[model samples]
Target: MKEIDKIALIEIKNRQILHVRSKGKLKFYLPGGKREASETDEQTLTRELHEELSININTNTIKYLGTFKAPADGKADGVLVKITCYTAEYTGNLKPANEIEELRWLNNSNLDIISEASKKIFEFLKQKGEID
Candidate 1:
């Protein structure tokens, strides 16, 4: 099995979680990406969000959520993705940048357009009553 490690920021509001659609992609994903060499999870989150969503993460507010794993979307069935999630305070308007084509606020009902790992996240949030 292949394991793809990544970090994600979970920003939910009004029953929706912030997501993004990258250029040339059909699914939406949480606002984060793979960690670079020798980078901490916090540093990865800080850089990815800024590059993709133009936001400044408030390092002081960073809180670890949980890690989720599922079949990697669009990859072979044996390929898996592990997403380490966090919640943090941020500033600046959310905008698509780099490869991101658009921003979306998604709920469980929108699972069809999300990655498998993201589906797990939706179910988790629903169980916690964080998203409807």
Candidate 2:
């Protein structure tokens, strides 16, 4: 089994989660990416957020949300993605940047359009009373 280690930002507002779709992708996902060598979770998420969303994640406000594992989207069977998620305050207008093509705020009702890992996240958030 192959596991992809990724860090993600969980930005929820008014019961909606901020999700992004990369260029040519069909599924929306949490904003983040794989951890670079020698980078901590905070550093990884901060850099990824800046690159993908044109925002600066305030490290001081970073809080661990949870880790989710699911079949890696667009990958072969037996491959899994382990997303380590964090909620943090950020500065700057959220816009698609880098490889991101669009951004959307999503809730549980939109489950059919998100990645499997993201579905797990939405469920977790719902169970915690953080979203509908």
Candidate 3:
């Protein structure tokens, strides 16, 4: 089995979470991407933020939010994705960049439109009373 390691930023505001739609996908995902070779978690997150949302993450403000795993979406059955998530402060206006198609804020009711991995995060947040 192949495992994909990724990082996700769980930016929450007013009980809503930020999500981005990929250019050729139906599901929305947390604004993040895979880690680069020799990059630290913070470095990977900073680069992904700049590339995907045109923002800069304040590394000092990053809070680890645990990790999650799920079968890799749209991939073979034995493939899995391991996601390390963090909540952080950021600078710069967010805009759809690179391969991003749209950016949206999602609450509990928007679960069906997001990817399976994100749904797990949504459930976790809801259980923690972070979102209603």
Query: Candidate 3: RMSD over Cα atoms?
Result: 0.9
Pick by TM-score: which candidate is best?
A: 2
Off by over 4 Å in 3: none
Cα lDDT tens digits, model 2, 1-132, are 999999999999889999999999999999999999999999999999999999998889999999999999999999999999999999999999989999999998899999999999998999999999
- What is the TM-score (0 to 1) of candidate 3? 0.96
lDDT of 3 by residue, 48-119 (tens): 999999999999999899799888888989898898999899999999999999999999899789888888
- By TM-score, the candidates rank as 2, 1, 3
Error of 1 at 114 (Å): 0.8
lDDT of 1 by residue, 24-119 (tens): 999999989999999999999999999999999999999999999999888987999999999999999999999999999988889899998999
- The CA lDDT of each predicted structure is 0.94, 0.95, 0.92
Worst 10 residues of 1 by lDDT: 103-112
Q: Candidate 1: list runs displaced more than 4 Å.
A: none
Clashing residue pairs in candidate 1, if any?
none
Deviating ranges (above 4 Å) for candidate 2:
none
TM per candidate comes to 0.98, 0.98, 0.96
Output candidate 1 Cα RMSD.
Answer: 0.7
Whichever of 1 and 2 has more lDDT, that candidate is 2
Better candidate number, 1 or 3, judged by lDDT: 1
